[model samples]
Target: MEHKIKVAVNGYGVIGKRVADAVEAQEDMELVGVSDVTADYRVASAVAKGIPVYASTDEARQQMRAAGYPLVGGLSDLLGKVDVVVDCTPAGIGAANVDLYRSLGVKSVFQGGEKHSLTGHSFVAHANYKSTLGRDTTRVVSCNTTATVRTLTALQDAELLSKARGVLVRRATDPWESDHSGIMNTVVPEGRIPSHQGPDAQSVVPNLDVVTMAAKGAHTQNHLHFWTVELTRAAEAEEVLAALKAMPRIAFVKRSDGVVAVNSTVELMQDLGRPRGDMYEVAIWEDILTVQGNELFWTYTIDNQAIVTPENIDAIRALAGTVEDGAESIRRTDRALGVRADFTATD
Candidate 1:
């Protein structure tokens, strides 16, 4: 029998819980355990799922024990127990913990919140699968970054993309993050141009020139991208749409399909019984795809809530180099997660 990849996820919030669940579903990956600050309801929920829970720090271990949930160990001990440690902690936390991962000799993957420089490699499996081979740490990148690379790289491979300019409609915080979220129904500008997403995408598809603008949306369900790209060749709208549809994790759906809003897209996922209501794809609004002269324009909403889980799965195998074929890993991960190219699969 082949050895399963022993994986541990740190920070059991939205991203960590999803990552832990994904690791469990992979045929060759075993979710060894999860760690987080001793937040009662969340950690208890992790316990309810039967995921072994651990404290995010030594100081929290006692708190966890006192809270009546069992702990396999603390965060330090978690490092010794797994082959890979996926750091889903808040921004900057993963970079802070890099030395620990090195000292323990465990490969770790960080989420996008950390700077790309934190780890030598920034990853988007479709964009740079082979780049992660034998690397000790990998940053799976943020949801916006994930959507950007998936969208542009698809068009790039077809030689359809010359340059991508997008405005990121970012959600303030997750809906479930109510305790610390609630910006008085504000839509705050991110106050930067060529937003971090552009450079982040370059980390994955290093040669591409993609600039982005960003804004905070009132809703917390998903992030939207309003994109205008210059295509190398003039093509019909249908041809452009077909090219995007061929991308591995991009889902094409339109209002004609009876889904009109991003929340509705999410509700449809929940109604369809998707795992944790995850719409793990670039949900392109199909009708908006248009070609004007040399520029191809469109808008799409990415379920920032759930798009990166499968990528996280692929990142695990990439960092480990345990899987030789990137396509094979993506296919298996998608099927396991029910991530398909159309809305019907969710509906």
Candidate 2:
């Protein structure tokens, strides 16, 4: 294998920590450093882990260190030092930095909310990694998109099914910082954030059709969302579920008990000992393939932010030719770990 890919994680939030850890776990990738704008407890934690930490300035770094993590310089110095920079900042600000990364000739993988199409491709590590790599930049789909894309990719490729419909009800780890934000004890309608999942999928593999809906809920951890799909073949549900249950990247697939549907994903995360206020556990209910002459409905749970970053790193590896394509990575990683993304559903 090639020398470990040097990776820099740019944002030190929940997703950044997970991404940094995931990078360290990889035999072929190295965590060169971690950076963020503000010095927070998360940054301190990264430093405690022995990863070099840098902020915007020595003074700023000292302030951040007081908050918790030791620091080095500012973001510019950190950016110049790594090969791939995973920008995990919140939506609005991340896009500008992503653009700067591209201009600097450093390949970048961005969190989904930026809603900016800065790169030539969007990636789903297990599904479309090969299609998105080596393109200067790539966007990991939103959490909901990551979950749905994983399922749809398998279905589209395995069963030749087409068309998907989903209703996504989201629970956040914390509320948005806007006073006008409909968070905290409020079930508000934020609608779907503009995303290119449908179009991106079509771009990657034509003849696939999908429609999606989104809602927001109040919580303070990673997002939990659901998807209902319409399949071209109902009888194929069993095979589809079996396939998903066998993928490694997927953490949990619901079991086929009448009382427990895929809706049990959140509870499953709790069982997995996911950190409080974070997304780590996932569950899916392979609901009976309600066949309306071939349309099938099923639901799945996702730890949104967490899903994207690991897969984004995987994408970077593929682009760097450090790993095989997405499908092969799934198969290989499954072999190494002895599990696949698990799937469970009731008939």
Q: Identify the leading candidate in terms of lDDT.
A: 1
lDDT of 1 by residue, 316-338 (tens): 99888889788888998988888
For model 2, residues 1-347, the per-residue Cα lDDT tens digits are 66878888888775777778777766677888888776655666676778888885566677876776556667777778777888777777776786678677777887766663566576777666777655667777677667767767767666646667666667644333334544678776655543345555554455667765666677543444444555555555566666665544654443544325323554554454544333332455545334454656655556655656457667667666666657666454334322334323221
Error of 1 at 324 (Å): 1.7
lDDT of each: 0.86, 0.62
- lDDT score for residue 344 of model 1: 77
Highest TM-score model number: 1
TM-scores of the candidates in the order shown = 0.96, 0.81
Quality of model 2 by C-alpha lDDT: 0.62
Candidate 2: Cα lDDT at 203: 43
RMSD of each: 1.5, 4.3
